[model samples]
Target: MADRVTVIGWDGSPLTAAACGALGAATLVAGAAHHLALPEVPASAERIRLGSVDLAARRIAGHRGTAVVLADGDPGFFGVVRTLRGPEFGLEVEVVPAVSPVAAAFARAGMPWDDAHVVVAHPRTLRRAVNVCRAHTKVAVLTSPGAGPAELGLLMEGVHRTFVICEELGTDHEQVTVLTSDKAADHTWRDPNVVIVVGGPVGATEGGGWIAGRDPAAGPRGWTRPAQVYGGELGEGERDVLRAAQLARLGPRLGDLVWDIGCGSGAFATEAAAAGAAVIAVDLDPRSCARTEAAARRFGVQLQIVLGTAPHVLENLPEPDVVRIGGGGAAVVSAVADRRPQRIVTHAGTRDAAERVGRDLSEHGYHVECALLQSVDLDTRAWTETERSVAFLLSGELTRS
Candidate 1:
C-alpha cells in the first residue's frame, strides 16, 4: 500500500499553499516531465515520469515514503485521481483541484455552462459524441489527439455551429480561436485542447436552467399525452396503456436515440422525448409529420420528424438504441432488427404476425417477449380482461444465450 498521496491539479496557474507544502515534503513525486521541472518540486525528492496512471500507482504503492502526483486541471473531473484511488490501487489520496478545462473554455467565451453538454471524446465512442454535438445546442468536448477539433468539425459540416477551440489553456502558449465548422475542418489544431461548440442562434445557444446539462422542466410531466392537447387524433391505438407497458421494455433514458416508425401523430415520439431520450418519428403522410411536429411543440420536446416510409427511410438516419413501430408490422421489425438496437418494441395485429416476428427476432440473436394487451371499456372507464385482445406487443433484446 502506498503512503498517503497528494494529488495536485494545475491549470498553468500558481499552486495553492497546501499543494506547495505537499510537494516540498514529498519523497517520491510522480508527474509528467514538465510538472517535474517546476521550481516547487523539492531538489531532494526522487522523480517518476508519468506515462500510464496504473504504472505510477503501482510504483507508488511499494514506496515507503510520502508521494505526490501532479496532473492538469481538476484531477477529479475525468482526471488521474480516480485511477490512483481505484479498487486496483486503493491508495489513500487527498485531491487539490483547479478549474476544469471545460469551465475555463466556457469562461473565455463568456458563456454560462449550466446548460452545456460536456463530452469526453475517445477513439471508439467518438461517433456517438459527434451525434450528441449535432443534437444539442451547447456542447463542450474534451478533445484528445485523434478525436479533437479537426475530426469533429469534418462531421459537423453544414450543421450550423460555432466552434470555439481553446488550445493550451491557461498557459503562455494558449490560443483561443473561433471559426465555423468548415474552417475548423481545414485548420490544424494543437494537442491538449478543449473545444466549445454552440449551435442555434447567437444568444439562444444556452438557457437559464437549474440543472447542469438538461433542464428538468424542458418537457411534459409524464410520458402519456392528454388527448385534447394534440389538436388531432392521438392515433389508432390506445397509446397511454401501450406506453406504460413498453416503458420498462424500451428503457428510454437520456443519451439514447429512440426511433418511432410509422408514427401516426407522434404521440409516442413526443412521450419518449419528454422522458429524456432523443426521438425521431417517421411517417409517410405529410399531415402526420405536421401533427408530430405540432405535438412536439405543444409538449416542449424536441423530435426529429421524418416524412418517409420506413425500412428504406431508416437507412440514412443515425443508429438508434431503441425502436418502436406503430404501423409497419412484421417487415418493419425485420428491418429494425438488422440494425441491432439494444431494444425493440412493435405492435403485431395477429398471432401469426407475432409468432413470425418472434421467430425472426430469435434467429437474429434476440430474446423476445410477446404480450396481448388487456382492453378497458372506454365508456365504463373500467379494466376488462377478455379473449378478444386489442393489440399484441412484442419486445426484444440482444441475447448471448
Candidate 2:
C-alpha cells in the first residue's frame, strides 16, 4: 500500500475531528515547533521538527505507521503539500485544511480580496514583489524576515499605497496596522506578517473582480498596435513592424521591470505592461508623459510615468531587468549600461547613432548586436510602391558578471 500521510492545516482554530484523530494516531509527526507543541499531537508519536521540508518529507515517507504533517493555513495554497505530493516521494496524502493566512489577513482588514494579487517574497525575488505592488492596485505580499514591510516601504517612497500590515495572524499576539506606504518604514514591523498593499487609500473597499490579480489579460488584445491606439502623434512613434522587432529583442516577461525611455506614444510601455512586466515610461516632454498615462488607463494597465531627461531621470527608479531606449542618444545608452540590466535594446533612428550605441555597449561588457529592420508597402491601384523608413535596432546582453 502507498504510504499514508495526513496533512493538517492549523489556522489557530480548534482542531476538527479528522485532524485530531489523525494526530492522535500518528506514528510520526512532522511540523513546526509551534504545531508540534499543540496538545492534539500524541505523546507516542516521534516528532520531526520542520527545518528543511525535504528532510521532513523523507522522515514521513520512511515511517512505518501513519504520518501526519502539520502546516499553517491551507497546505495546498503556496504551502507544504506540493513538496510532499511529488512522484519521488510515492505517498498518498489526505489534507485537512483550515483558513489560509491570505484569507485571514483580508478578513482582519475587513475587505474583500478576490481581486488581490498574492505574491511571496523570498531573498531572491523581493524586488519582483515590490514591482507587483508598483504595477497593481491590490496585492498581498507574504514577506520573509529580510524582505518585509520596511524593505517594501523604502521601495514605495513616491507611490500611493496604503499598507495593511498583519503580524502573527491567528495568534494571541496578532496585530493589524493600517498605514500608508510612505509611513510604513517608520515602524519596525514584526515578522511572520502579510502586508496588503492597497493602491489607493487605507481601508478602501473594491468591488469584486471577475478574475484574480491585476489581470495580465485585462489590456489590449495584441501587441504592435497602431499609433492611433495610443493617441500619439501620427507617424512619430515606433510603427507596428518596428515595435514587434523591439519587443522580440527586449523580451519583457512576468515579474520583470522594463523601462521605456523616451516613451513617445507610450506604445512600447503599454505593450510591456500588458505582457505582465512592471513598466516605467520616462520622457522629457510632459505631453509624452501625459499620453503614456492616458494610454495605460485606456488599456487598463499600469505604467509609472516620469517626466524628466534621461540618465538624470533614470537614477531614482527601480532597477530594470530589460530596458528599451526608444529615444536619447549615446549618453543615454552609456548611462543605462551603468545600471547593468540583463538585456538592453536601443532603437536608433539613424545609422550613426546605432554604431555609437553598439560600440559603447560592447565596451561595457555586453555582447552587442545590430539589425536593420526595413519594410515596404505597395499601392496596388496606383501600381506604385515605396520603401518604409529603416530602423537600426541595437540589442545587447551582459557577457560577464
Candidate 3:
C-alpha cells in the first residue's frame, strides 16, 4: 500500500515539472498504452497497462510504494478520478490535470462555450446525447469508439446543425473538420473525437456568456395566456383554465418531447415549449400551422411545426413523453397511445367522444379520468360571462406484455 497515489492528466502536451517529478519517483505507474509509451515516463518504473480500471486501482492500492496514474484530460470530469475516489477504491490521491477534450474542442473551434451543453456518449447511451442536441441550441458530445461522429450525425438528420469534429485532440494526428450533420454522416470519421452541434441563430460570433444552454433559474414566469394575445380565430383555441390543467398533467420539462396533435392556434404547444419542453405541433390545416408558428414566435418559444393529419404524421416524429390531442378523434388517440407516451390529455366536443377516448386509453392500461371544466369571466359592465368545456385527461404507465 503506497502512502499516496498521484494521478496525472495528459492532453498530448509536455508534462509539467510536478508531473515529471512524480512520474520519475513513482515505483508503480499505471496508464493507457499511449501514456505508458510516452518518452517522458521513466522506463524503470513498473508499468501497469490500464485495462479494467477497477483492477488497476486495486493493484495500485496493494503496492507498497509511491504510485502514479496517468489519465486523459481533467480526470475529475467523466474520467478515472471518480472511480479512484469512490468508496470501492478510496485511495487518498493527488491530481495533476490538463485541459479536457471538451474545452480543447471548443477552443479549437474558436467559440465561447460557457452556454454550450456538454454530453458524453458511450456506446450504450448515444441516443440520449443526440436527443439533447435535438432539443437545445448548442451541445458538445464526447464520443466513444463505435459511437463517433457518423453515428451522431445519423440521429441529427432533420435538425439544422453545424458539426465541428475534433479528432485525436492535442496529438500529432490531430485534425479538426467542420461539416453539416448530413455531411458528417456521409463520411467516415476518425476515432477519439469530440462533436460540437450548433443550431439556431448562432452565427460566426455569438458573443460570450457564463451559463450553459438556457439558464434553469430563468424559465417562463407564467404560462397562462389570454385568448386575444394569439393570432387566428379563437374558435378552436383552448381556454387558459383548461390550458393550465393540461400543462400540469403533461408535466413538460427540460429534455422532454411533447406532441400537440391537431394543435389548434398552437396554444398548448406554445405553453408547453415556454415551460422548457421540446414541442412538436401537428395539424392538417395550413392555417393551424401558421397560427402555431405565430404564437410560438410571439411567446419567444421554439416549435417544430408539422403540417399533416395525425396518426400518419406522428409516425415519423420523435417519440414523446407527453401528448395533447386537441382535435383528433378516437383513432388519433389510439394511434398516439400505441406510441406509449407517459401521459395523454385530450379534450372532446361531445360526451361520446370523451367516453370513447377514455375507453381507448383504458384498453391501453391507462388510468382514465374525465372532467367538465367551466369558467366565468367578469365583463366590463360588471356582468358575469360563462363558458363551459369538457376534457378527458388520461395517464398511464406502459405495461409491456
C-alpha RMSD of candidate 2: 3.0
Over the stretch 152-192, how does candidate 1's per-residue lDDT look in tens digits? 88766435678999999978899999998778878889978
* Residue 36, candidate 2: C-alpha displacement in angstroms: 1.7
Q: Against the true structure, whose TM-score is highest?
A: 2
- Global CA lDDT computed for model 2: 0.84
The per-candidate count of clashes, in order, stands at 0, 0, 1
TM-score per candidate: 0.87, 0.91, 0.88
Error of 1 at 356 (Å): 2.4
Q: Which stretches of candidate 1 lie over 4 Å from their true place?
A: 153-160, 180-184, 200-209, 377-389
Q: Which stretches of candidate 3 lie over 4 Å from their true place?
A: 202-210, 217-220, 233-237, 298-300, 349-351, 369-372, 380-383, 386-390, 399-401
C-alpha positional error of residue 364 in candidate 2 after TM-score superposition, expressed in Å: 2.0
Global lDDT scores for all candidate models: 0.81, 0.84, 0.80
Sorted on lDDT, highest at the top, how do the candidates line up? 2, 1, 3
lDDT of 2 by residue, 1-401 (tens): 22589999998999999999988888888998889999999998899999888878877777888899999899999898989988878778999999999999999999888888899988787999988887777899999888999889998766778899999887889999999898887898887899998874221224554677655454446667776676745333377878888898888877789999988888888888777788889999998888888777776676788899998989988899999988787889999999999999877778887888899999999998898887776687886774466788789999976
Q: Sorted on TM-score, highest at the top, how do the candidates line up?
A: 2, 3, 1
Q: Look at candidate 1 and give me any clashing residue pairs.
A: none
For candidate 2, give the lDDT of residue 351: 82
